[model samples]
Target: MRGHDRFNTSLPDDLIIEIFRRLDSKSKRDACSLVCHRWLRLHRLTRSSLKIGASGSPDRFLQILSTRFPNVTDIYVDERFAISPPPCIQGRKRSRDNSKVSSEESCGSVGNVDSPYLSDAGLAVIGNGFPKLEKLNLIWCSNVTSDGLASLARKCTYLKSLDLQGCYVRDQGLAAVGQCCKQLEDLNLRFCEGLTDTGLIELAVGVGKSLKSLGVAACAKITDSSMEAVGSHCGSLENLSLDSEFIHNQGILAVAGGCPHLKVIKLQCINVNDDALKAVGANCLSLMSLALYGFQRFTDKGFFAIGKGSKNLKNLTLSDCYFLSDKGLEAIATGCKELTHLEINGCHNIGTPGLQSVGKSCRHLTELALLYCQRIGDPGLLQIGQGCKYLRTLHLVDCSSIGDEGMCGIASGCKNLKKLHIRRCYEIGNKGIIAVGKHCKLLTDLNIRYCDRVGDEALIAIAEGCSLHYLNVSGCHQIGDAGVIAIARGCPQLCYLDVSVLQNLGDMVMTELAEHCPLLKEIVLSHCRQITDVGLTHLVKSCTMLESCHMVYCSGITSAGVATMVSSCPNIKKVLIEKWKVSQRTKRRAGSVISYFCVEL
Candidate 1:
């Protein structure tokens, strides 16, 4: 030990720092901190990012964080810090009724020492502490008002990205951001209800030139005027996500006309129609990704315009656009030949014609999602399978019309398919899945939840042909021990597995897993009543690398089995079981090794 210490001491500080810089894992760095005071100090100095959650003493926590990671450029404070009040303020009486308190008073009361949550006082500490902070994510910090934001903006002048999602930042906060934080580029003000057109205009006028990405969701008061101001000012904006009730064509038109370099746009609006989309297609020639949700008024004409203009569009998502039929989708497919990803959900009118158009025109398409598009059947999938041979991912949910034929087509055509998720598609059966098992040699992730027709035959086929990393056949009642055993024997690289609600699964399956699966990290055996303590012990003893074990409602499992699992698996982080199954002794044992031992009621 002395010789080793002497040898380590001979290594220069710069070499040690370089070694620490190479460590990408937080756990490895934490272990280094325990080596000695010198190592701890070096680790702290090298740390450049910090994420903090609820602490008993927030002031002390902030002090330690600032002292340890003085060079941290990014800080993320989770919602727990805002929701969980410190003990000192928990028992204090409110000066006024909670409901009657003004937003400003509730959030910006810096003088109020009794503030339960992290108020402006906490923000002041942050502003003064981290001088190098370039990114700050105060997500869902509702108690943080305009005053806190102003303070942060003034102090963190080099801040490039700010996420004030669910904060009480009003016009004052926007004004401060505009006046200060000249280097700010990315801003997310989602769910900031206090923001109006006035505040948005001010922000656009101030930081529009440098801002690259902006998200303003659920800001009800923002209208066309604010968007017009943004369009006129924010010429450099590349990504924009807007979800507002009052925004219409005029606002969109202004944005399209101004931000010529815009690459991505996500809009969820009630008033936006074909005209706005036409304007976007015509003006934003650089657009690569577009997502429209719940836009009831958009029709084929708008899609035609988009296809005609935005030839470079690679990704498109249309959700709940009930008015858009096969014609609109066909138009898009014909124009956007470079599209790599397309997702259509709740567009009931879209059927085989639209999908066929996509398969024929968008040969480069790699990912496709059809959710609740009941009109689409095997013909549509067959078309896709025949045309889009490079397709890698396919998601089908509640597409009742799609059956074995479609699945077979997909399996045969997309030989390179890596991920396939099918849920509530009862029509698909063993024939379809077996084909996938045989054809998709590179299949890594498979989820067929609630696909009742899938049985042991499908699993056996998959186990024989494919080396899957993730497999979730939960609620597939037809799958039994044979299927699981085959999987355990075949998939040596399997990291995640969920066989929840399989009544037939028993100790035999566990025995197979123990002998075959050494890389299994997470397994969900929820409601598998036949799983007993004997099998679980064997499994836990063998699968030492298991990180998460969920055995909710496994009636055959007892305290002794739980104790063995918690004690044996040093890397185990989470365990889920029934409330009654966790004895006092087991709880104590689990409390040390497990980070989250949830007791399901």
Candidate 2:
């Protein structure tokens, strides 16, 4: 006990913080919240920024800040929803004399109330309160009129970054906020469907020269004239994301010709033919990141240009671009050596040779996603395994051609791999998964879903060798109780398991599986029709941590079983029940019980 205590205490605060920094925002919040009040105090003191805008509970956020917590410098007001009356309407309480229209009629559109958590009044309250805010990410706040933005701009004058991505703002809002925030360096207007070139022209002609980053992603309304004029004017623009159309070669050429300091560019679903990309490559010498996913006109020519130019590029994505072939990969291999992440999803023409070139040359690569690359067979997969030694993630989902050989190669060569996804690889059987278990001993996520040939043998291997935390063997028809038993015995750290569509998993298997993996938190056993009350009873009794359970099509389970699980496993956050129900009251009670229980816990 003393030794265990000492080991636990040995972990320092700095170490924990550094670890937490890598975690997602939600997980970090959860972890911080879990480590006792002392940790909470420490976290509040150490945390540099706090954003509580997803559901905009400004009161809750302020409550957290009131307790001598070091001021949250970076506050994000995620899209604010309007709970108040529409602009045209006066108050919430409607008159009995006048037949009040529905909320949509009052607001002109239902989307105005979709985020229904915040109001302009609420945001003004925040602006009035947190005056020292540094960064504000206001993404998809469609209902937040220009008045709210202007108020925020006036209040948070110390803000270095302001995000207005997807808001219903026009020229007046842009003109107001643009002149107000003198220190604003970053602005994201991606999919701000209401923004016109007139508004953009105002920003460009006036204060655009100060901007370091700007986003216009999926802004289909932007034309070549506006972009050309704007690109030439915004001399400080370093990063940009365009909607992949309208802004043609001339516009990009204007940008390259003007913004000498431009670095990162993302043109998703754009028609940037070879010449445009080449122009960017030739001009943007300081370019660091480029995502040209879904650019139908981009081909090997663009890759060649990138190889020749853009020497500082660190991230590249080429998803759904059909024209990229082996030659382009060869060019990329020869050119960019500092690449850390590469995504080539849906590039069917890029076969073994191109993959081999990439793997062999891009030694520093940490994450490689070849999702939906069907031409990647055993030989190609093997080459990747042998080449990319530093690879951390290998995603080959929906690549049906990979059989035993490819799986074996990945297992053997990519020892550093933490996440291996071979989902829907129908050709893979026990042989490949067994190989994976044997080689990638440190594997945390193993997704072998829809691999029908994989059965008890594969699970047995994984259970024995791999220290897996997340296991998804969904749709593996051959998997039986023996396999679940192996999972129980081998993976003590197992937290998430999906055995959906497993016909052989009966009540006994569920009992054993739940009992075996005490740390089981999330289980998806959908279509396991053989499971009855007995299995679920045992599951509820054993796996108290079970948060989300998908028991859809589980015909054997009755409302009594559900009630037992809900009552027993107080932490069961989500229970997806499609058919079975005792009563409407029972259903409502279950939902209410779960909500109350989760909050209390």
Candidate 3:
């Protein structure tokens, strides 16, 4: 007893609390709390954030949570809370009928008034419990209405950021928020269908001076009136995202002329012509990031204005802008010489000349993505590869014109590349892949999905040089045991691998994986009919750290093999296989240990 007491030196309370605060994992903190009563009290005092799921009784749970972690300033309510209604409201009938409830009162009439799932009463409990709450995220809480939001706003007066995505809150809630939360800076109301111009105007008038970031994407009822209100009131707004078909050039012009200090703007499916874009370029000189999607009306004139004016632009994304051609891209590339990231999707009119201009001008470019740009061919890619030597990530999807020459150029030039993804670029084959494997020594992630021309030669080269952590050659029918065996032998740190639909892969590859890749966690062998029970057993017995294993449609695996894997692999959590291969006994026993998914016959 004396020896044990001598070793038990008491640590200072402040030092113990600091140690608890440094722990990153919740489970680790919980374990530390179990050591003694003093440690548990210190852990609770240090914790400031709590994420609650929708499984327990809200009243009782919130009571206990407030008692234990009284200092928590942030709370995130899971989406599952809306899917599964609270148990207290399961059998109770709503006080108001749906037919009698008007559109304005729908939020308050969702369920029983006493129930916490849909009523303002539930929010009152949270507001009363956590008065110091600064950030609250209630994403997908569709049943909560304006009354609940008003109650929460009145109590949590210090709130700075509020995310109510997919909620049923309308104008009344915004009015309450503006009246109560004076320091609010960040607000997201994306997918809030009930919000209209009236509510937004109220919110803007109240909190416009303090607001920095505002997102009202997909609010169909809002029109030019709301944008005008925001521009007139919200002078300090910097980041804005607006998605509405009703908004046109007049609204965009107001925002551009009013918000001169804006840094980021994202517009989706808005009916704006070159005039609006020109206004943005001329007025918002501080803009650094811009994303435009499905704007068919914009032409080269708008892009030219942006390029000529917003010279400090660093990131730009253009998607489905069919009318914008090579001239527009060239203008942007020449003007925005400091661009670091560029993404072009479904812009078929922009071809080799535009890309060549980008390659020549944007030497600081680090990331580039070109998707469904059929007109962009090998010459364009070659120019990019030759110029953009500092590029780290490159993604080419459905760019059928890209061939071996373009890929080889990229491989040789972008020696610092870390991630490369090529999907459905059928023109690229073994030669291009071999060049990548030979030159890209720092490459950690490589995905060549559905590129049938890529085979063992490419994989063998990668295994020999690149220390890849993730490799996915799924749908590459030419890949076999020789390439995979080489990977197993060389890339010992490989964590994720997918060889689905590779018919030539057999037990030899599994044997090699078992012998070499002990850290392997997740593997997908779907549709590989050649893999047998022996190979499955060998993999599970050695790779004890495997958490997820998928072998769907593998006819050679039987119930015995499935049972062996479920019993032997201690860390296995998810196993996906054919329904017919699992026996009733195995299913019953595995139910407690792992989640098993069956592919229906």
Candidate 4:
């Protein structure tokens, strides 16, 4: 059907690259690289980022990376595990073994192994190799120390963003980074217990003037001293996230008062009161986003102060703030008219008036999430639907008082709504979900997990109305083949379906779903005992693109059925089965037969 000139040799270099770019998976890309020399070269050159995992020898991998992909700018080194010893230790194994411990003894050492994958030696190689590196994320690289970081900074002077979350980098490492990496703009040091105020102060003094974003979350030792240094030097800082108990009101005030151009701030589990809020409001008038969590000290007074002072505020999130009431919410509604996204979780004090005020005032609000707010009933949702007509994403979780009335209001008003998640709302039934489907035809993602009252009527409505790609109706015992048949007929483009724990689902629904939903990739049938081998055979034969099938506690599925499924769908990667169903040898064979098979039983 084709000639030699119409092949790869005739295609232009740019066209080859454009075609290669469209390949979806890594296997396809790797296969394309094997075609010719030009393709391999183009593939190598087009790549810009690299991720090195803690699997094989890091030294050898680094050597390969340096040789094959030399122009990589972004590198993410995940050192979450320990494999064999580093090349330095391996080379001198015999000599080291005579005086020091053996491999078994080394592996048995207490706590986490330092430099399990890439150690100081590996860092030296990296520093020498990637000269043009800009962004380096060594997240959970617990072994990297001061020497390695200093070497990286000295060699890679172009580095701008560095994340060392969960690393053991201490004050010395901070000092090294501060002294060498002066141009660094974004730095995250979350959960690094080795860091103290002295280290933080040195870092602030070194790059504070140039730094734009800084995250020092879970660094409990950091105090007002470090905050003072950051406030004084980091005047250009626009975003800061601090989750520390040691840094009290003094630290908050210092940072707020000093960073005049500050726009975004997130504080968690801190004992900050109205004084800190007032300082933030007064100084950071340009602030647009603020998030506070787990504090009762800053009540209505603090919120009112923020509302009155920071009139340009747009995004606000409050969680577990028991002290906040309708008064505080009203204050926010009156002041922050430019608000677009609002999320309130675990704050039960606010009533219907609070949501109504927010909905009426923040007319441009597009995203809203109200979770674990028992006081918010149908009245609150109705008000939100009536006022915030442009709302696109809505999440109402554990709001037991909300029922069909709230759903009707949202369906009637918010025509542009796309993503809706209502979980554990016992009051909501088929009426609410059906109303949602009847009104919101543009819906793509819908999650009604643990809403036992929703059944065939709701699914039928959803199938007819929305072109849903992801649908989750887990724990709805009333759902049966009729509802699933409706889904198969309506949502032909469905890719992900979760019908777990439904008692009435049988092989008929599975057969129809497999035959109709050609795009179906993942399906969860856990606890659905009615599904047998007939369903599995039909699913494997029809859904050729299926990747993962979770059938935990599915007693009807035996070893023969699983074997048949593997034979039918060679592309099926993950087949999760309950532990006690098959033998150990069978489990091992299943894994060998399929790419990814889990037998936890």
Report, for every candidate in turn, its global Cα lDDT versus the true structure. 0.86, 0.74, 0.85, 0.82
Candidate 3: TM-score?
0.91
- Summarize candidate 3's per-residue lDDT along 1-601 as a digit string, tens digits: 6456321266788888889888889899999999878888988998888775554334334554666787889987765653333333333343365434232232233233343443465577678878899988887776679999998999999998999888889899988999899888899988899999998889888888888888877888988998999899889989989887888998899889888889999998558899999998999999899999999899999999999999999999999999999999999999999999999999979888899999999999999999998999888878888999999999999998999999999999999999999999999999999999899999989999999899999999999879888989999989999999998998999888999899999998989999999989999988999999899889987898988888877877888888988888888888887666778888887865444555445
TM-score of 1: 0.91
Cα deviation of 243, candidate 3, in Å: 1.8
Better of 2 and 3 by lDDT: 3
Clashes in model 4: which pairs? 578-601, 579-601, 580-601
Query: What lDDT is reached at residue 268 by model 3?
Result: 84
Off by over 4 Å in 2: 1-72, 78-120, 204-210, 233-236, 260-263, 579-585, 593-601
Residue 85 of candidate 1: its Cα lDDT? 40
Model 1 over residues 93-180: C-alpha lDDT tens digits? 4446564323333233333443334567677778888999899988777777898889888998999999888887899988898889
| Candidates arranged by lDDT, highest first | 1, 3, 4, 2
Candidate 2 CA-lDDT value:
0.74
What lDDT does candidate 2 reach at residue 56? 24
How many pairs collide in each candidate, listed in order?
0, 1, 0, 3
lDDT of 4 by residue, 529-568 (tens): 9899888888888888888888878878776777767667
Q: What TM-score, to 2 decimals, does candidate 4 have?
A: 0.89
Give per-residue CA lDDT, model 2, range 1-601, as digits (tens). Answer: 6436552378777766666556678566667757676566556645666544544234333433534344556766564442222234333334577555333343332222333444455456556656777787766766567776777667777777877777777767776666776666787887787777777776676567677887776666766766776676788888887774667777777777778788888886464688877888888888888887776787899889988898777788887888889999788876888777888889878877887787777778878777888887788778778887788887777877778998788789988889977678789999988988888888889887888898999888988888889988899999998998788778878899998999998888777767678889998877898998889998888888888887767888877877787778867778766533544656666764332112222
